[model samples]
Target chain A: MKKERENWVDMAPDALLGYAVVVLALVCFMILLAIVVAGVRILTGMGAA
Target chain B: MWHRLTLEDVKVIGHYLGVLVLVSAIGLVPPLLVAVVFGEWHAASRYLLTSGIFLIAGSGLRFLRVQPGRLSRQQALAITGLAWLVLAFFAAIPLSMSGHYANYVDALFEAVSGLTTTGASVVQDLDHLSYADNMWRFMMHLMGGLGLIVVALSFGLFGKGSASLFTSEGRSEHVVPNVVQTTQFIGRITLAFIALSTTIVTTLCLVKGMEPARAFLQSLWVSISAFATAGFVPMSQNIMYYHSLAIECVLMVVMLLGSINFTLHAEILRGRIKTFFEDTEVRITAVWLIAIVMVFAASLAASRLMSDLPAMERRGLFMVVAAYSTTGFQNVTTSQITGSFASGMLIIAILMAVGGSAGSTAGGIKINRLAILGKSIVATLKETLAPDTARITISYQHIGRRPVTPDIVREATTVLILYGTTYIAGALVGIASGYDASQAIFESVAMASNGGITSGIVVPGMAWHLELFYLLEMWAGRLEFVTLLALMIQLVVSATPSSLAMRLHARRAQRRRS
Candidate 1:
C-alpha cells in the first residue's frame, strides 16, 4: 500500500463509516423504545398511570 | 445517459429500500393511534393510505430478488436518495388527500419538513387540522429526527445500505459494525428520553391545570419534537398557544438534548461523561449557544423592543436555541424582538446557518464544521509563526478525533458551498418575486437550515416558485448535501460520454426484464 493521501472525493469510505454509525444509532434507539414500551406495559398493568 | 444499474446493485438497493419502507409503514402508529383516540375518519383515511403505501412498498422490496452481500457504494447512495423521495411522496399523499394541501407536492413539502425534523410547514391551519393529521406530522418529525432509514435498518429489514442511509441522515460517526444494532441503540436512548421526558412534562402541564387529554397529547408531541430536534406544533400557534414557560423550558431542554448526538448520550450511559466536555463539537456548540444568547439579549434590551425585561431574557435564550439548534419551535415570532437588524435578525440568521450537532436531527453547516474551520484557522496562523520544518497535525474533536486534513476541509467547504449555492439560488428566485435580497437570503438560510424562523417570507399563497424553492431546500438540506450531489454526478457519469455504459447497463436491464 502506498503511503499517500487518497482522493478526498472518494465517498466510499465515508459513506460506509456513516452507515455503520447510523445502524448503531438506530439499534440503540429501538432498544430504548423497547424498554419504554415494556415499562409502559408494566405500568399500565399495575394501573400506575 | 447513466448506466442502468445491474441487478446486483438493484437487489442491494431494494434490500435497503425495503427497510426504509418498512420503517415508514410503522410510522403510522402515531397517526392511527390518534385516529382511534379522536375518531376522525378523514385523518384515519390519510394514515391508512400512507401506511398502506409504505407497507406495500416494503413488502414488494422484501419479495424482490436481493443480493446477499453488502451494497455497493453507488447502490447505497441510490437507495438512500430514493428512500427519502419514496417516503416523502407517500407521506404527503395522506395530507394531500385529507384536503390539508391542494396538491401532493405541498403536502410532501410539509411531510418532508416534519420527517426531516425541519419543522417548517406549508400547512396554515394546524390547530383545526384533524388529530390524525396532526399526529402524522409529529410522527414524521420523530422518524425524520432519528432518520427514516435508521428505523428501517434497526429492524434488520435493511443491512448494507445503512452506510449511505446514515450519511444522508447527517451523522458524522457511525461507530458500530452492525447497522441494525446501532439504530437500535439510538432508538433505545430516544425511547427512554421520550417516555421519561413526556411523562414528566405532561405531569407538569397537567398540574398547570391544562386539560388532561391536552396535557397527554401535548407532552407526547413536545417530547418527540424535542428529542428529534423538530419544533413543529400540532396547534396553529405552536408553543405560544400554551404561553407557559414551564412547557417551553421542558421543550427547550429536550430540544437541546435532541441537538446533541445520541452517541454522546451513549457515552454518558457508559459513564464516560467527560467525553462530552472533551468533544470539540459539544464544546463549540456550548460556546456558540452562550455567545448567541448574550448578543441577542443585549440587542433585545438595547433596542427597548422588550417591554418586559425577564420576558426578554427568557425568550432571547429560547429563541436562540430554537433557531440555532434548527429545532424551529417558536414561542416568539421574528417580529417580537426589537434590536438593530444587525444584532437580532442578522445574528439569528447566522445562528440558523450554524445548525445543530451532526447525527442529531438538526440541520445546517453543523458545529463540527465551525469547529474544524476554527481549528484550521488557528493551525494556519500557528504554522505561519513556526519554523519551516515544523510538522504538525490538528483535527476537530467532535465525537472523536476527525483529522482536519485538507480532505476534511474540502468536504466541509463543499458542504458550505452547496449550502450557500442553494441559499443564493433560492434567494435569487425570491428576489425575482420582488423581495429584497437580504430578506430572501435570511428566509433561504432559515429554511435550508430547518431553523424555521421566517421574517414573513414563508406564508400561505406565497409565490409558488419561492415556496417550491424553500421546499426543495428543506429536502436537500435534510439529506445533508451529499446524496443529491452524488445522485446527479452518478447519473451523469454512469450514463454519458460512452454509449457503452448504458448499452451494457441496458443488457443487464434486459436480462432482469426477461
Candidate 2:
C-alpha cells in the first residue's frame, strides 16, 4: 500500500487529471451545443407554422 | 445551551487569525513588485503601507496567544467567518488609496467582491487602472478560491484542530486522509491547470496581434480567474475583449474543471474514470446543464434575441457555461443581457442559484445537495407506491454508494431554504432601492451565488445601502449559511441583556449545585 501510494503521487497526478478534465469539458460542451442548436431549430420551426 | 465566550476564547481565535493575516501579507509582495516593475510608485507606496499595518496588527494579536490546543467548533466557526471580512478590510487599504474608487466604501466593496471570488467590482475606469492593482484582484481570487483556511492549513500553520477549521470553511471531504495533504493536493491541481491554460491562452492572444508583454499578463490573469472560477477581468470589456473562439473555449473548459469536486479530480487522477462519471454531482450537473441550455436556447429563439444561428451558438453556449459554473466571465454586454436577452437572464439567474458542485471553488446551493434532494423526491414516490412494511432504501454514487437518509435530506432542504430566503430578502432590498423587479432579482442572485454577471445595477456610485447589503450577501453566501449563522448567533447572544442575565442565572445554579 505504501509503495502504491508513492507511485500515485510520483505520477504527477495534477497533469493527469488536469488534461483529462479539459478533454471531458470540451466533449461535454460540444454535446450541449448540439442540444441547443436542435432546440432552437425546433422552437423556430414551431413559431413559423 | 451555550457558554458565554470568555476573554481567553477571544485570544485563541485572535491568535489563529493573526497567523492567517501575517501569511496573507505575503500576497502584497507580488503586487508590490508589479508596481515597481511598471513604475507605478504611488501604488507601491500603498502596498508598503498595508504590509506594515498587517505586520504590526498581526504581531499585536500574536502577543495575546494562549496555550496551543485543539479549537472548539465555535472558535473554528468564528475564525473562518471573520477571516474573509478581516482580510477584506486590510486588502481595501491599498485599493482605497488607488484613487480609482469613489469612496472608501466602494473600495471595501471591491475588496469584498474580490476576496469572496464573487468577481463584482465598482472601480471606476478599470481600463486605465494600474497593473499592480489588477494583479492584487486576481491574487485575491486565487487565495479566496483555495480558501484562506485551506491555505493556512496547507502550510500547517494551525497546530491543532485543523480538521475542524477545514470543515468550518465549507469543505467536508478530504482527498487524502490528512487535511493538510488534501489542501496541498488542491493547490497543486490548481497550479497545474493554471499553468497549462496560461500557455494555451498566451499563444492565442499573441496570434491575435496583441503586444507580447500585454498578452502574457492578460493570459495569466484570465487563466487564474477561470481556474479559480472567478470573474474579474483585466480589461473593462470582460471576456468580450478577446473575441476569440479558441480563448473562450479554453476558458470554458477551465471553468468547468474549477467547478467540479476536488475528490472527483483525485479519482480521475487515480484512473477511476468510471467513478468520476458515476458520481451523483457530475451526473446531476450534466442533466442540469443540458436542461438549462435547451430552455435558454428555446427562450432565445422565441424572443428572436440573436437571430443568427452562429452568434446564438457562441454566446448561448459560453453564457450558460459561465453562469452555470458561477464564473461570471461575460461575453455579452450588460445592456444586451438586460434588453434583448431579458428572458435568457432569468435562466442565468436559475443557473447561478443552483450553482456548481459542493467541495469546489464555486458557490451556491451546490449540486450535491440538489442531488440528495432530487433523490429524496424519488424515494418518496417509491414509498407511496409500495404496500405497508415494504422496506425501502435509497442510495447514490458520490465517491461510492452513500445512503440518502432523512438527515441528509433535511440538511439539504435547510440550506436550500436558507439560500431561497436570502435571495428574496436581497431582491426586496434591491427593489426598495428603486430598481425594477427583474433587475433586482437578477442582481441579487448574481451577488449571492458569487456570479459576477452584472445587469447595469452594480456601478461605480450605486446607493451605499445597496452596496453594503450586496457585500454582506457575497460574504454570507461564500460561508454557505452555517458558519455565518453561527457567528451571528454568537454575537447576538453575547450582546443581548437577556442572554447575559441567563448566563448569570446559570452560573448561580452551578454554584448551588457545587
Candidate of highest DockQ:
2
Model 2 residue pairs with clashes = none
- Which regions in candidate 1 have their CA more than 4 angstroms from the true location? A1-49, B1-4, B7-15, B61-63, B175-177, B334-343, B396-403, B493-514
Predicted candidate 1 versus true structure: per-residue lDDT over B1-514, tens digit per residue: 3434655666767766776778677788878988978888767776777677888888888777765766666777777777777788778888888776756667877877787677777786677788777778888887887777677767776445566566655664664566676788788778877997889888888888989987888888888988887877877777887777777766766777777777776665544555666888877776666566555655554444442345554566667778877888777754552223334777788888888887776789888777777788899998999999997788766556777899888888888889888878877888888986777777888888888777777765666777778878887888877887776676566556575565778789999999
Model 2, C-alpha of B190: deviation from truth (Å): 0.7
Off by over 4 Å in 2: A1-18, A46-49, B501-514
Q: Against the correct fold, how does model 2 do in TM-score?
A: 0.95
**C-alpha root-mean-square deviation, candidate 1:** 11.7
For candidate 1, report its TM-score.
Answer: 0.84
How would you encode candidate 2's per-residue C-alpha lDDT over B226-272 as one tens digit per residue?
98888999998989999899999889888988998999888778767
The per-candidate TM-score of the B chain, in the order shown, comes to 0.91, 0.97
**lDDT scores for all predictions?**
0.72, 0.88
Indicate the worst ten consecutive residues by lDDT in candidate 2 chain B: B302-311
| TM-scores for candidates 1 onward, in order | 0.84, 0.95
